[model samples]
Target: MKKIIGVDLGGTTTKFAILNEAGEIEQKWSISTDIEREGINIVPNIIDSINQQLSQSGLSSTDVLGIGMGSPGSVDIDKGTVIGAYNLNWKTLQQVKEQIEAGTSIPFYIDNDANVAALGEQWKGAGEGNANVVFITLGTGVGGGVVAEGKLVHGAGTAGEIGHMNVDPNGYECTCGNVGCLETVASATGVVHLAQDYAEGYAGDSELKGLIDQKQEITAKIVFDQAKKRDPLAKKVVDKFSFYLGLACGNIANILSPNAIVIGGGVSAAGDVLVDGVREYFEKYAFPPVKTSTEIKLAQLGNDAGVIGAGSLVKMSR
Candidate 1:
């Protein structure tokens, strides 16, 4: 019973999982991402952790198919190098393959975290093995990945960056040096910012307004909740967020014509309220053929998507 090893390396924590040949996760665990010493500890920590886990479980490189990993940055799959992930204090990481494969004696594969999450969903979540899928993650910011004909598209390394998709030329400035990116309006922080911007100078009777006036911490989830409770102000904000999200998805669908566009990340916890709102606008903006063919879906894997997707990378490569 050979297994696959998946590693989802994040800025704060790294997740690990063992999955059987059939794509079922057997055991999963985590380790804090040690960004100290220029992220030099990251690879060594991973190597040590995987080796220990395998040893304890009576497994070894022979029992494992491969190790797949998802990390944040521009990853050169061919070179096995990571370039400049500042959040992780990694200006540049070289010899990733040399370190991991040498340490573990197992072949290693890596990709951008967003792309790996998309692959994970396609394999075991909302995508359900769809030949073509678009995965959008709306967290503090937006992230996306594209799978075309059952293959992850890795064009120039950063191909599926939906968050940076320019939505407005004069809108809010994005961290990516763009004005009015999809992430500026569709991410959780984006949603909250939209709520605040809309709340200014409004003579409306609403719970959302009350929270804003009191300087309460208003999260994207709160806005969605208020919208569900029929709060007019919150409804307005959510409507705007959904419009931008749907418009983005609609355009992507027109270009890629994927089987489904799946939404994930923390903001997705808003669930049906978020999906329904996006769907309404997506239908209106999508091309006729795409509107009917490409389904909008919510990601089912949640926190596990990254690790699972990373595992799928090994299984897929085989």
Candidate 2:
């Protein structure tokens, strides 16, 4: 059986999968991300894992089709180097593709993690093969991928960074050192930040405020759950969160006019409520033509979007 190796290299864990042409996972596994020496050992560890897996599966480099990866930070695809991925300890330009191909002697392909995820959705998930699509992931931080004319857009290595869009000039500071980036209030932590901001001096019997008063952990999940029950404070947070995100999406729609803007990542699990709220604002802010043509939908592949999308890099190359 012909095989393709897909790697999703994340900060906490690196997930690997062997996928068939049908995009079905024949096997999958993960290893804790190597943190020693700013990821100096990460490449070696991954190569070793591939060799071990291939050996056990009675496969060899010649038997496999190719390998692809979705890695954090901006990727210089032609050079296979990763730039400024702080979490991965890949602080400088590392020849990721060259090192990996040398280690395994197998053809390798790569792209930004978010871009690959977008391709995955475009190919087999919510996008359903739409030629023009946008993928927005609301995790601890927000990430985005823009696809146009059936290809991922990586302009100067950082084109679809929707998370950094200037949503508020006076908003909270983001990890990117920007004030009021979309991520400051639209990500998972953004939900929590909204909840905490609304918790102070508001007197209408708010469970979210109570959680804040007691110095307890407040998560986006709790805020979303409370919103479901019509908790005023939680509703306020969700409404505001949805506003900025939708506005950002609206602006993007005007520019790219993608077929669908697929929302995913952990926060998207709130389901219809999140989608509906964003849709309400998206309609308000989007251009009339874009409003009529573009669709906003939730992602279908879940965690698998990464690996499947990574595999798609090689698949498309072939």
lDDT against the true structure, per candidate, is 0.92, 0.91
TM per candidate: 0.97, 0.93
Candidate 1 residue pairs that clash: none
- Report the C-alpha lDDT of model 2 over 1-318, residue by residue, as the tens digit: 689999999999999999998778899999999967988988999999998999999999988788999998778888888989889988878888898999998999999899999988998899976899999999998999998998888887688789999888899998988899999998899999888888886789888888889999988989999999998999999999999999998999999999999999999999999999999999999999999899999999998899999988988887
Q: Which ranges in model 2 have alpha carbons more than 4 Å from their true place?
A: none
Q: Relative to the unseen true structure, what is the C-alpha lDDT of residue 100 in candidate 1, on a scale of 0 to 100?
A: 95
The residue-by-residue lDDT of candidate 1 on 51-145, one tens digit each, is 99999999979999999999887788887888788778889666787799999999999888999999999999999769899999999889999
Error of 2 at 67 (Å): 0.7
10 residues in a row with least lDDT, candidate 1: 89-98
